[model samples]
Target: MSDEHSPLIPASYDIVWSIVTVLIIALTIVALVTLARSARRLTATQALIWTVVVLFIPFLGPAAWLTIGRGGVPVERT
Candidate 1:
């Protein structure tokens, strides 16, 4: 028998939510670091564009910059 409103939260749910929350925090930190580092290598206009993208779009923006916008190539060594 269950109570009408016993704050019905399960332990599994709590664990899942905790994991999700941690992942989000970690992703946000990584995104900010990537944005800062990439911004330093870009021109003023490009940096501004990327900044807006990362700020407004969140996850996809940062991933896009790292994967696609960064030219996706390895630099040659002399």
Candidate 2:
């Protein structure tokens, strides 16, 4: 309770940020692997390019892939 306000910095903030960063990176990697594992359908160059796109653009990357990639996947509908 001081006259001047002092911003509070939580000790665990760095840890939380580190964890979140790791998760984002892991998700990016997962997106890359998903495209990579489906290589029979996705050309090697296509998969590599998409992987770079997804990793570079953050939300835009994943969103684009989710919207476009899902549609491209072949589904057997009887």
Candidate 3:
């Protein structure tokens, strides 16, 4: 009889990958929501460009927006 091969990915690694995937998705959502809710900080064209960046570039897009992109905007507390 022929021998069977084992699975390529281990169970522990699968869990870790799942967590990473969820985190990336969550970060993207938060970035998009924050961008949408900004009060006149970004113009329509700028917002559209940022939306494309955040959606297409995934990890880096959202990270850049949250860090460098939003740097010049002032925060309002009500």
Candidate 4:
């Protein structure tokens, strides 16, 4: 038998996956933090619903929150 070995997955693939995972996690965290801080923008029920969306749907959820869901008429402050 020949002494040779090869990996089914390349090292680059692992690196790419690691980067992707980190990005997704970071996106989720940022989305949640922004959601929490925007208390005036969302009511308790709305915030809860958005939290569920952001947590359950992963990439698309957070992306949607940052883009569409988070947008609205700006609240005027005294």
TM-score of each: 0.55, 0.59, 0.79, 0.81
Report model 2's TM-score to 2 decimal places. 0.59
Please give, for residues 1-78, the per-residue lDDT of candidate 1 as tens digits: 775443677777888988976875566567667767666567788778877776677567766766777664234455
C-alpha lDDT (0 to 100) for residue 29 of candidate 4: 99
lDDT of each structure? 0.69, 0.72, 0.85, 0.86
**Candidate 4, residue 42: how far the Cα is off, in Å:** 1.4
- Scored by lDDT, model 4 comes in at 0.86
Cα TM-score of candidate 4: 0.81
Best by TM-score: 4
- Candidate 3 collision pairs: none
Model 1, which residues run further than 4 Å from truth? 1-8, 56-58, 71-78
Instruction: Evaluate model 1: give its TM-score.
Output: 0.55
Backbone atom clashes (below 3 Å) for every candidate = 0, 0, 0, 0
- After aligning candidate 3 to the native by TM-score, how far in Å is the CA of 30 from where it should be? 0.8
Candidate 3 residue-wise lDDT, 26-54, digit = tens = 99999988888873777788888888999
Could you give candidate 4's per-residue lDDT for residues 1-78 as a string of tens digits? Answer: 974445787778889999999999999999999888786667888889889999999899999999988785255587
Rank list by TM-score: 4, 3, 2, 1
By descending lDDT, how would the candidates be arranged? 4, 3, 2, 1
